[model samples]
Target: MNNKFGLSNEYTLAKVLQIKHYTRTLFSFKTTRPSKFRFKPGEFVMIGLILRGKFIFRAYSICSPTWHNALEFYSIKVPNGPFTSFLQKITTDSSIIIKTKSTGTLILDSLTPGKRLFLLCTGTGIAPFISIISDPETYIKYNEVIVVLTCRFSQELRYFNYKIKQLLKQPHIESHAKNKLRFYLSTTQEPYPYSGRITWLIKSGTLIADLNTYTLNKRDRFMICGSQQMILDVVNLLKSIGYIEGTINNPQDFVYEKAFVN
Candidate 1:
């Protein structure tokens, strides 16, 4: 049923716990999790604010791991954009509404068992992988987890790097993530040793050379999230290499979510 805010009962209110600004355009916020809420690591939930009795919201991939006490999201501030413009002004004293249900194809359950897991993302698409990498179950599911993140600058990568290091310090997760997690960072519009789109890097064999692993193994699994064009490029490349897209009902070798980026 609809509520006074013209929202369904599926939504619940939560106070913002903290907000971290990575750069002028990038930020992340944590909201108190509903005690009864439950979600897998890579899932996303709708979060928004209600104004003038109308709902203004967007689907955001959860950034923090499930083990964390609160729900976290990484977002890009779009000047004058409908939701984010307002979101950027919120403080810890403010509250946001979150949909109780969460869903996404990037969760571990969406792919079949594999020898290795590859998470390829660009920009804010790294949110889901951030959660995936912090989860201990990820280490148990695959022999190794490879993350390829491409950004416009190095500062964005630093946020992700710090998150990983923090997770590595977590008692139950450190041992697992430390042993199995690996990262390859690239910047497109900035000066860096590894600078370029990840898809281009993969196609050019530069990614493989840097990682020292060439060719996709038959037992390798993939989860990609990025710009629509980036997703298309990676999907076509993976398909050419014999990887099959999958769904939760019938797990396959790969999956992708374009929700995070355009």
Candidate 2:
């Protein structure tokens, strides 16, 4: 039997505050956050629903900053996909099941002190970075933040780009965002500019060349989220260059998370 909004023992119900559809397959929604619920900028939590008394959930990275009163998530609509398909039914009047405890390898604590932080992602992998980039703590931790994203189509990039642009316009952070944050965007299936350089943009030095920034130094840190292959490719390249991975993250010169939600 379904309660007011499908209750579950391990999860709390959050009312949907708003929803925005960026594309036919891509959408973002906000939900009320429980006062005691807490998570780091890059953490992900289980979100889903209880159907027929069975709980179905998937890991979704929190897209909003830690200080926000509401939690936000960006999702891709996979046709007939497990959670995505079921998720299509929810609306502003709906309530969702959110596991209180959140966890992930992409948190800032995993990385040692560094001067430059590179956030590399593809497609919806950009979710966690959104929170990371907007967090004031991230600005305090690193002098510069560079975000690189690639997808098959330009529309797939609207979320990250829009969020970054929006952040640049905000009042207090405007100066820091403009002076410290940089974005490189591109589309693989088509010709568009992003941070990627050479045949493998994430692993190449082309971004520094294009940006006229300082060369890659040991003080630079990296965080990656994307397909498994993309993660492996970037990790291998970083390790080959002697970048030590986070000891907390199975030893990578970088930290990574697989966000294959589609």
- TM-score of each predicted structure versus truth: 0.95, 0.90
- Candidate lDDT values, in order: 0.87, 0.81
**TM-score of predicted model 1?**
0.95
Candidate 1 local lDDT, 1-262, one digit each (tens): 2365566678888899999898999899999998789999888898878866678879899988887889999999988888898898889999999999888878788798998998999888899989998888899999889999999999888678878778878889877877678889999988998889977888888888998875778899999987888898899999997889998888999999846545
Per-residue lDDT tens digits for candidate 2, residues 1-262, read: 2255556455788899988888889888999997699999999999977676778889999998888899999988999887888786689889888888888889788888889999988788899999998887888888999988878888888887678777777676676576788878878776676534323763566777777888888899999888767777777888887887784645434788744523
- Give the best candidate by lDDT: 1
Question: Which parts of model 1 have CA positions greater than 4 angstroms off?
Answer: 1-6, 258-262
Best by TM-score: 1
- lDDT, candidate 2, at 163: 82
Question: Which stretch of 10 consecutive residues in model 1 shows the poorest summed lDDT?
Answer: 1-10
